[model samples]
Every structure is written in structure tokens, then in C-alpha cells.
Target: MDGGQAMIALGIGLTSAVDGAAIAALVRRALAHAGLEASVLAVPDWRADLPAVAAAARLLGLPVAPVSRAAMQTVEAAVATRAPESLARYGVGSVAEAAALVAAGRGARLLVARLAEAGATCAVAEGEGP
Candidate 1:
């Protein structure tokens, strides 16, 4: 437990609202802000489908969590941002938060609340693993 666990297994959630470059930067910031070692992040399966998300994952070596909608719904309450559109469509405030929580898995907790920047939104969650 040196340095209080250098690396944190963090997760992210996003949509097509962002481009590849921005996604990459968002991902980078998430890792850097966590101040972890050999940083790694996980995104929901749907986010992986986004060209920008895929590109970011490739650029940062981020893992794409094979999460299901049922799983994501389980963490809908944990989300911080409350958007009317997202609530009506996904039953969650932010897809990013839902996905981040799902990726983190059981006992998952928010490390960084949802952040909307550069036309994209993301949230960071920490759990047992990606």
C-alpha cells in the first residue's frame, strides 16, 4: 500500500458529443488528475462504439468495459449531473456517470464527478478494477 496505492482503477463515461482529440485529452486529464501510476481507464461498451471514444481508447490505452444497460441502470442514482434529455432517454442524469459506475463494478464509487468540457462530458469512478 505504498503511496496509498499509486494507481487508481478509474472509469469514464462519454458520448459522441466529443471528437477524437478532445476525448483523448479528457481521458488524459482524468488520468493525470487521479495522479496514478501506469494510469488506466474504462468506458462503457457503447462509448467504445463512438469513433472518438475508440480513438481515445487507442491513444491512451484505455480499456473499454463490456457493460450492459441493465448494469448501468444500477448506478443511475450515483450520477451528479442532471440533464432532462439524459434522464428521459437513459433514466440517468449523465451517461458518462452511469457508464463510469458500471465500469467500476460493485462497490464502485465516484472519484471525479461528471465534467462537461470541450463539447463532451465525462465522469470518473473507482472500483476493484476496470
Candidate 2:
């Protein structure tokens, strides 16, 4: 499939209620750096406050994919970066990385690892689409 046909999932982790503009800016930069367009925004299901992420996805015209904590944990072993605090609190070393991988489905690989800005984090994962 062509590059346009490929889907890239963006996983976001937030510590606070960030503004949609901030999240969108970060996602845009991260995606530009990776030379990929995001097909969807993925967030941890346990996170109740998701207005920022939801708004960002709407701003970017992409769908939101809520990944379960179990699914995110399952991909933790494959994550390259390790966040001790995150692991202690959420049982996942890198929530963004893990969430991206899980939301992208099987065989998905990280296109851009966690990129942090203020209270938010972003990661991108690429997967094949049928």
C-alpha cells in the first residue's frame, strides 16, 4: 500500500488537563518529524479526563481510539523507553508507546517514541491496513 493508505496511531498521555491547541501543536510536530500523518488518537481507557485529547483529535480530524490498560500493559515489554514513575503508577513504563502500539493493533512498530511537552506526551506507531 502507498504511504497515504498506511495508518499511524498517536498515543497521548497527560498529567493535567492540557489545552487542545497545545496537544495539537505537539502532535503536529511529532508527526512532521516522523513524516507521517496520524490516523487516530489513542488514550488510556483509565484516564477519565480526556477533553484535551478529544479536542486535539477533532482539531486534526482524526478519530479517537481508547486502549484498555490491559492492552497497554501487554505492549510494555516491547517499549524502548522506560519511565520509572509511570511504571510504578500505571504498570507501564511508557504509556504513550504502549498505547500507540496497542491501538495500532498487531505488528505495529513505533514511528516516533514518546515526545513530551509540559504536561502531555505523544507517541506514534505505524501499522499496515488491509
Candidate 3:
């Protein structure tokens, strides 16, 4: 699946989450482990963090999506990894997983659960394409 399309959710905040070193590194680590490529990044709060989010997308050579709190919330039940902090703060289990699902659009499903290190996380999801 090296060339196949996939949606990747990235933890994106300056201090809150990031397109930071740890999280960005995990994007490759997680996708490589799962045999996927990064075609899109589902940044959960890209609207409020546009520049960083855009920079991350440009750096990764992929598109970035804005995943709203409500959109992520819609996929809470679909996440495999549960972060207590995320649950309390965002009403979702895993921000990465939820963002991935939301970015993947309707009929999306998680292809990989949340992967974390250094307070950052990543997840992958795919949709039933047209």
C-alpha cells in the first residue's frame, strides 16, 4: 500500500498538540508500520491553528483538513484508543483517530489505531470512495 491513498490524523498544536517533532515523526512511523502513505492530514483544530497546520501539510507534501470539534465528536465511538484527557476536553476518545475518520469522510473506518509517544498521537483511516 505504499502508493495507496490514506488519511492521517496528526496532533497539531504549538503546545497543546503539534504538527510538532514527536507527532510529525509518529506520522511516518505509524504509516510505515501499517504499510500506508500520507495523502492527507486531518488536523483537529486547523482553523484556529492555520499557519502551523498548513506548514505541516506543506512539509509532508500532503493536503491538510480542518476537522471540527463536532465532526470529531461524530466519530468518538469509532476510535480504538481512548485518551482520558482527550475525552474530558474534547468529548472524544482519541483525537487522532477521530480526526482521521472525519477527514476520511462518510463511511470512513480506522485503518490504524492511535499511536503515541512524547505526548503526541497519530491515526489513519480510509473512506469508501466514489
TM-scores of all candidate predictions against the true structure: 0.77, 0.90, 0.79
* Winner of 2 and 3 under TM-score: 2
* Poorest stretch of ten by lDDT in candidate 2: 1-10
RMSD of each: 3.2, 2.2, 3.7
Candidate 2 lands at a TM-score of 0.90
- Over the stretch 1-130, how does candidate 3's per-residue lDDT look in tens digits? 2365544444332335444445567777877887877667777774446554566566677766777899889888888887798899889888888888887766778888877776566788877431
lDDT of candidate model 3 versus the reference: 0.69
Off by over 4 Å in 2: 1-4
Q: Which candidate, 1 or 3, would have the higher TM-score against the true structure?
A: 3
Angstrom error of the Cα, residue 81, model 2: value is: 1.1
Candidate ranking under lDDT, highest first, comes to: 2, 3, 1
- Sort by TM-score, best first: what order? 2, 3, 1
After superposing candidate 3 on the true structure, give the runs of residues whose Cα lies further than 4 Å from its correct spot.
Answer: 1-14, 17-19, 46-52
Instruction: Give the alpha carbon lDDT tens digit for every residue of 46-126 in model 1.
Output: 666787766776777766565666777788778778889878876778777777777665567777777767867667776
Best-matching candidate per lDDT: 2
Give the candidate number with the greatest TM-score: 2
* Worst 10 contiguous positions by lDDT, candidate 1: 1-10
